[model samples]
Target: MAITPNYYETLYITRPDIQEEDLAKIQQKLQDSISSNEGEIIKADKWAERNLAYEIQDHKKGTYYILVFKALPNASKEVEKHLQFYRTDILRFITLKTTEEAVNKNKASEEKKEKTEPTTPTPPPAAPPTTTAAPTPPPAAPEPPTAAPEPPPAAPEPPTAAPEPAATPPTEAPASTEEAKTENTDTQEEGGTN
Candidate 1:
């Protein structure tokens, strides 16, 4: 009494040198025809303009058009009828049903797993509170005793160290203000893309 939508996809080949205007019309026509027959065109793909494995109708090159649509079983027959009119222009086409329902069923079954299996694992990380006792830390080592206080030592003067080497700035200073900021940023950061 009711028609269930099915995932259907088909691919066809067209003339390699078809004009850009003609190409859009050709693609839209397929979509329009599908919609007219109680079908919805999900997506269309222009795979590539490729040379045929073997010559078909004396044409060695063809443009591949792939269409993915959804509709009832009878609507697919009408799609085939549209493809039948042109044997030369369109070299070949094939329609196949996508098993989406089976795929969704598999997804649902995976979701149902946690319900059937135990919510909590057999051995939980920690059981309900059974008087959680705090762990005691290890004893600290004893400090060494003070040595005898000797005579007061003389204060040493601060020793002078050699002067640090002066840094030489980059040779590649960018000419523009914008470029200078960018180059300075590049120098500051280790990541120099150029």
Candidate 2:
């Protein structure tokens, strides 16, 4: 049987506090693991640090990194296991398979953008109209109304107090009272005997 290589992209976030040296070390370790499994690294890049949508391991923000590689089927399992074991360094990670169709589509769109971008400059503001028209006096401001208009009636004031708390059920209150009475009688009997 012929073995087929799979292309995968993994995005992971590292704790924001990790030092530069340690970050580099972690990257090297991942690269080594991939190579040892006969995988080829196509790209490894770090994106800008950003705030996470939710906290992970008490970290509010993390540095994002993406690794694109080609590997055998089982290589992904090993990579995930490694990241899981290093919980302190990695906050979160996800790996996804890249399909040939998607990659081709992306390349086509990028080429189209590049080809069209330079040819269009913001069409210079429509050349000023070639002919000028006689300037008309700005329409005279509407004559002020003869008398000041009456002010609108004041709006009703909102109620000052908050809505009353929901009423408790009658049955619940009686049950609690009965329990309290029983406890009080027991305490009274104990005091008298002593």
Error of 1 at 50 (Å): 1.7
Candidate 2 yields a Cα-based lDDT of 0.68
Which candidate comes out best when scored by TM-score? 2
- What are the runs in model 1 whose C-alpha is more than 4 Å off? 101-194
Give the per-residue lDDT of model 1 (tens digit) for 31-146: 76778768887667786889999998888999898777787787677777767665546778898888777545645885798576786585455654432432222232222211
Tell me how candidate 1 scores on lDDT.
0.62
| Per-candidate TM-score against the hidden true structure | 0.47, 0.55
Q: Weakest 10 consecutive residues, lDDT, candidate 1? A: 148-157
> What TM-score does model 2 achieve against the real structure?
0.55
Error of 2 at 122 (Å): 11
For model 2, residues 1-194, the per-residue Cα lDDT tens digits are 97777888888999998888877877777787778778888778886699999999899999999887788767777778777877788999998999767655755886898888876665434434422332333344433331222111111112221222111223343344344444555666688798
- After superposing candidate 2 on the true structure, give the runs of residues whose Cα lies further than 4 Å from its correct spot: 104-194
* Model 2: lDDT of residue 179: 46
Error of 2 at 156 (Å): 16
Q: What is the C-alpha lDDT of each candidate?
A: 0.62, 0.68
